[model samples]
Target: MDSLTQFTLGAAVSALCLGKKLGPRKSALLGGILGTVPDLDVFLPFDNPVDAFVLHRGWTHSFFIHALATPVVGEILVRSIGALRESRARVWLTVFLCFTTHAIIDAMTVYGTRIFWPFDPDPVGVGSIFIIDPLYTVPLLIVVIWAFFSANWTSRFQSWLVAALIFSTSYMGLSIALQAHVENRAETIFADAGIDARNVFAIAGPFNTIVWKVIGQEDDRYHNLYISLFDEDDEQARVYTHPTRSDLTACLEGNDAFEKLRWFSRGYFGTALQGGKVVISDLRMGLTPSYVFRFAVAEYAAGNVRSIPPQAIEGQLTSLSDDLNWLADRFVGQPSVRAAEASGGEPYGTTETASCVERQTSG
Candidate 1:
């Protein structure tokens, strides 16, 4: 989720917990600031991009860290605000709500969260909602702002605030339900195509949940689909074969850097030989033709393999202009077939050669 949504959420929660005692305005301000504190780990130093990616939402976003920090921050609030000096416990609760809600909401996104932290560094994600959705934030923001302006924390005002929170939370439930529906659709599509899908993952489209993107991974290929819930006809599936490897993985089987990337992607990756280089592309992000996380893990020579330092590689672009336009169409519950094709919609891994691992065969 974006920082604005997190800030508004924190503000709303704090107002609910301590609005009356600390005044609505003060409570909102305090909560909004504290809510954004957990994300400050982005400034922490890291040796490499892989570490940076994996370390994000680690210790700082952990529930344990927030829990421990709550009392400390609450004490500062208690001392700073004369009105709440006597209400120490309520102040702590207020801080706790804001801080913890940030982690909880982040866990709902596709990137997942390490909210449990030291217990396990595995990212816990629902994979239901996209990082940004106006439907989730706009309505809640309206009500939160209204609550902030109200002079008193009257029962009616509190009811309105709680109702807003309920609506937003329920939207998350809807996202999950829609994801299940999409998975079933994907399975049926794969079945009809006579493709055995080893794994299938569904994610909501860019900004809205009405459109879903499904990826079905197989041993030799992957099927991708963009389905609009409001579409009048069944969506067509696009098939893309995995790039062929010439004993690349067999040679660098246990290379350290590649192993780390393998773990990070949970094995959802594509391999290609570009310029005689073996690159592993993280399939979780970016569309198939243009992925965001490709790394050159090894170099191939004649029949030998040598492990090299991992280097970030960029995906090939079909056309930037058409890609943006087709993306916009999908966001609005409609897709243009011509635009899709022009925008690298031919199938997955089409451009994943030359600059990708299959480059060795290129002229």
Candidate 2:
């Protein structure tokens, strides 16, 4: 989730837990600061943009780290402010919950959190909600602001905050249930179309339930299917396949960086081949034509028209939306280790497919 959401959630939790003791203003301030702390990983240096983006939501988000570090953090915070001298255990408990809740909420978005760091390098993504879901954040923000101004600090204020949290959490649960429903509908659609695909993944787009993307794999190729959840049934699936190009496999295969990127992206990538080069974009970041990490691949060559190089293709691929629907679906559902096997309906293989592009212009 974004910083505002983090701050609000943190503030709300803080106000709920400590408002009675610290007063609403002080509790909200403390909660907001703690909530925003985990995301500080973004300031750390990295070898590249990809590394920076990939390594973010790491260590600081870990439950173990929170448990071990909260006491020290709490002591420093308490001493700096000269506030209530609450028990070290109680202070630490509040800090732990505030920090862990921040990470847990972040894990529910498309860009997930590495909450299980050291124990597991893989990101734990739920993909049930967008990083900036107004439906989830606005109500909380409104209540927190109202509490801040009114200074009532009454039970009604706390009750409202709790109710908002419950609503947001419930929405998260509903996203998972909706994902299952979308997947089943997609499978039936695929069967009717005579497409023998095994793996099927569905993800909801940010802020709305009307649009979704489903990715299904058949043989060595991955198919991108876009569906509208608002439709009466699964009658609106649009399918797309990767374009045949040597650069697709050449760029992605046997490349450790690309492999890690793919895993991190949960295979929701778009590729383009131009001037014999390839450019890959993770579709999870909306349908923008630019790579999230500006320097993930080589730059485009000037004035060259023929023999599209792998790098150029990769750049062009940024503009395409072949699997964007799937990316949206995956972002909402969080990528499961068993997703590939369950959706693919067979043993997963290590083979890579050619990147897809519309048969029109290279750009």
Candidate 3:
């Protein structure tokens, strides 16, 4: 999830764990910092973007790392803060909960965390909630602020914090249920269309129950599907067939960089050929036109045309449906026409918005 959500969750958990033992102010402060510790890997300098991408959310977010690191962190924190002389076990438990809570919250989103790292490197993404959901964060923030002002480790305060956590966690669970429903519906749609596919993944977008990006595997290629959960009657499903090496052999003939990017993106890519050069995008991160960094054959283009030219990649690619029929057909297994329509909707999956939020926060 986003930083604010993690921070608030950490603070809330910390406050509840240390209720009365260490005042609300101290608990929130410590918890907020500990909550953000897992994300510190982003600051590490890497030699290349690929290394950074793979290394990030690696060992730091692992369950084993949290188990070993939390006690040391808790011990240091207790000694420096000098508030909770609690046993090492108690401190370790608190720290573990705080860290695990952070990881669990992250796993709920599309950009999953490697919770069982060194054991499972593949991201465990639930795609139930958006990374930054105001609905989830605002209430938690309200309670944390209330706790900060009250500074009273009373039962009432604990109740508020616990309630907020329950509400958010419940919502997360509901989102997962909803995704399953959407996936079943999508399967029916494909079956009706006579398309053999498996391993369908559905993700709910931020602040809305209507939009989702569905990815499924068919034969040697992957299919990108956009569905609107709210509209169950629409017959317009935007489906894109991502080219496998067999599909791209003609296009990417002698291009090594493009091949490397394809490998980097794990075959989840979109390409735009302009001015005799190719611009590739990894759609797993949402569909901002500029989200694609441009690389060209050095010999063909004399002067620089901007790595990813602004003019070449126009509107944001998304799967938003204003019509109910399209939504209905997308879910519940109905036959829908497979044609590209001009959709002015925001792209279904990607962390560009989160990046914008991070940038704003950093600024």
What is the descending TM-score order? 1, 2, 3
lDDT of each: 0.73, 0.65, 0.63
On the 0 to 100 scale, the lDDT of residue 185 in model 2 is 83
The best candidate by TM-score is 1
List candidate 3 stretches off by more than 4 Å.
219-222, 234-267, 271-279, 288-363
- The clash count for each model shown is 6, 32, 19
User: Residue 340 in candidate 1 has what lDDT?
Assistant: 33
Candidate 1 lDDT over residue span 177-240, tens digit each: 9999988987887788787886788878777888777777766555667777766555454444
TM-score of the candidate numbered 2? 0.77
Which residues of candidate 1, in runs, are more than 4 Å off?
147-156, 233-235, 244-247, 274-277, 300-305, 328-363
Summarize candidate 3's per-residue lDDT along 1-363 as a digit string, tens digits. Answer: 788888888888888887566788778877888888999989989654444544567677888899989878988867876567755566678799889988888888766678998887666667778777887788789888887787667877878888998988887777888889879877876776666867787777545445677777655556667776655453555465553323322334344444445555544555544443334555555533434333332121332222321222333443455334544654544545433433322222221111010111100
Indicate the residue-level lDDT of 345 in model 2: 18
User: Per-prediction RMSD in angstroms?
Assistant: 4.6, 8.6, 8.6
- Native-vs-model 3 lDDT? 0.63
> Better model by TM-score, 1 or 2?
1
